[model samples]
Target: MTRCRLCGSEAMASVVDLGATPPCESFLAADQLDQPEPAYPLHLRVCTDCWLAQIPPLITPEETFKEYAYFSSYSTSWVEHARTFVDDAAARLDLGTGAFVVEVASNDGYLLKHVVDRGIRCLGIEPSVNVGAAARDGGVPTLTEFLSPDTGSAVRAEHGPADLVVANNVYAHIPDVVGFTEGLRALVADDGWVSIEVQHLLTLIEENQYDTIYHEHFQYYTVASAIRALASGGLALVDVELLPTHGGSIRLWARPAEVAGEPSQQVVDVLAREKAAGLQELSGYTEFSARVAKVRRDLLKFLITAAERGETVVGYGAPGKGNTLLNHCGIRPDLLAYTVDRNPYKHGRFTPGTRVPILPPERIAADKPDYVLVLPWNLRAELTEQLSFVHEWGGRLVFPIPELSIVEVAS
Candidate 1:
């Protein structure tokens, strides 16, 4: 009797199931190692009514984001991406000092810092205490609590409605997707716009990105699904932009009810394209389980062969996507000696489920393993360039998804 969170449809089918796994970001300290890691069912389902791809109800927001460990400033590309977003949003929305900008799940003030620099009033709603503190230190006013209808009303009572609300890569993390969007409607002014960026579900299936299936991500959205979800909260989609970040993503711009903006042709075109590709059809998600199985077999085989050959393998980027991949493939310290992450919070900790040690990138230079597995495959080019020194040891970079391959650095 599992119902769709968006459309209230009881008709749902299991699309892909990754089994039980630990919360992706729940990295553990050495002292905490003695405690057993809690795991939950990580299964995906498709709603027949709305065509929304999503995970079965399992964890809540309070459980997932409280005291979060991820800091966005650690990634160079993410920082630059935030900067570009601020610039583009400012110009597109004609925003200035008079306007107010609000970002939900504003991790470490990565994007708000730029908005504040332009003299615009910016507010951040971040549930993670440590990350919110970092955002405050970076000069962005942040509220450390989950965004809900009550919280949204309280924020509106104090600061009035916002001119722009930005939610980058956070739309999927919410358990009550309907309530979250209703809160967005309450916080935004009648004529104000809300922008949401999410990793596209179409891109995930096409690119073999089963790694993105984790408990933290409750929903995998397509434009059609998003349109339905937003309209349910009395919002309308006015524009859509395809972004290269996070492998492939869609940035959707929406406005409050009765407020109209020129709907972009890109929005119409993409919706039509998704329909043509069968995203709206029940059969579209039928083959996903098979695809996921193939990925698991391929990755496991590669890891087994590498271990047998005595090739030292290590992981790059302790991102949530990496956790899903590692846990699904049953990768442990035996297969991956350790993982390197730029985020200080994750450094010195061990990845959830896999329990592989996490260290700084400097470890790569010190250990010089025979192969470095790039987990954040979206940033393969950037990561490869950063670790080009592997060439000195005649080591090659390996990527398991899309396909397993060993790449040699050009001299």
Candidate 2:
């Protein structure tokens, strides 16, 4: 009888249960192996009242982000993405010299660095100690604590309300969605704007991207649900944009309820599409769970067949999504010799639950495995380009989820 975190609605339906899984990024230290790992039931539920998709009994932010290992600066595409966001936002908002830009959950100041370079006053609120230190090193003033109503009030009192507040891929991580959004209300100036980007639930279901289900990400959002959630916190959705990053994401621009701004056509169009697609109906939830089960079956069959044929398989991108997919499919080192990641912090560590060793991308060249399983399928194009040398050795790249396909190099 798990109730909805937002509306306290008991009329909820189970979407997909990922079974018990370790914290997606809890990469193990050598000494930590002696202790038993803790895994929780990863189940998703949808509320009929609010149409919000979330997990049962949310974990605390401190347990989720403190000493976080996932760094945004490691990925080249992510860095470019952040730069583009900073450039576009600064231009659109006319943010210049005296304007203050605040980024919530700013990992290592990836986007904030670009803001700082433009001679604007920028502040980053990061909960991760290691990441906050990195931001500090880059000369971005950072606050190392979770953003709450009290924290937001303190920031407003000290530095005054911000001109632009940016929260990229953080809307889903916060358990107290209403409180966090209310905090935004407290910290943003009357004329200020707040921008948030989250993985679109409509796209996740349509694309069968069940891999995005991890403990750190407690909720999935739709524009319809988001507008309602924000409105409850004294904000209004002013505009929305579809971004290609992270499979598919929705970038929403919001302002205080009293501030008048022209709502973008894109926002209206997307909302209509969501409603037409029955995003507010219970049937949409039913279809998503079925699609997810099919994905599990298809992926498992491919792995078992590959293993029987004596084909060597390895994985690419030790991302959190990849961790969920691996654990859900029950994939271990036996099925995957090792996985490669660009992040140095994860290179020597073993993936949670699976215990698959994460190696540097260079290892792929040395081993020359027959098949490389691309985990972060959203970045397939970028990863394939980097691992193009595999084609020279007659090896093919395998994409497991959504469908099983072997990408052969064009001669």
Task: Please list all clashing residue pairs in model 1, or write none if there are none.
Answer: none
Could you give candidate 1's per-residue lDDT for residues 129-204 as a string of tens digits? 8899999998999999888889889999999999999989889999788889988998999989999999998888
Best-fitting candidate, scored by lDDT:
1
Backbone clash pairs in model 1 (N, Cα, C under 3 Å; residues 3+ apart or in different chains), count: 0
Tell me the lDDT of model 2 at 17: 81
Among all windows of ten consecutive residues in candidate 1, which has the lowest summed lDDT?
402-411
Over the stretch 1-411, how does candidate 2's per-residue lDDT look in tens digits? 378877888988888888889989888876676789998889988888999999865467798788888888887888899999999998999998989999999999989999999999988999999999999998989999898889889999999999999999999998888899988888899989999999999888888888998888888999988988888778899999999888899999999989936688999999898887788897777777778878888878877888999989998889999889989889998889999998898878899988999999999889888989999898877777887889978898988666677898543
TM for every model, in the order presented, reads: 0.97, 0.97
Query: Every model's Cα RMSD, please?
Result: 1.3, 1.4
Q: CA lDDT of 119 in candidate 1?
A: 98
Clashing pairs in 2: none
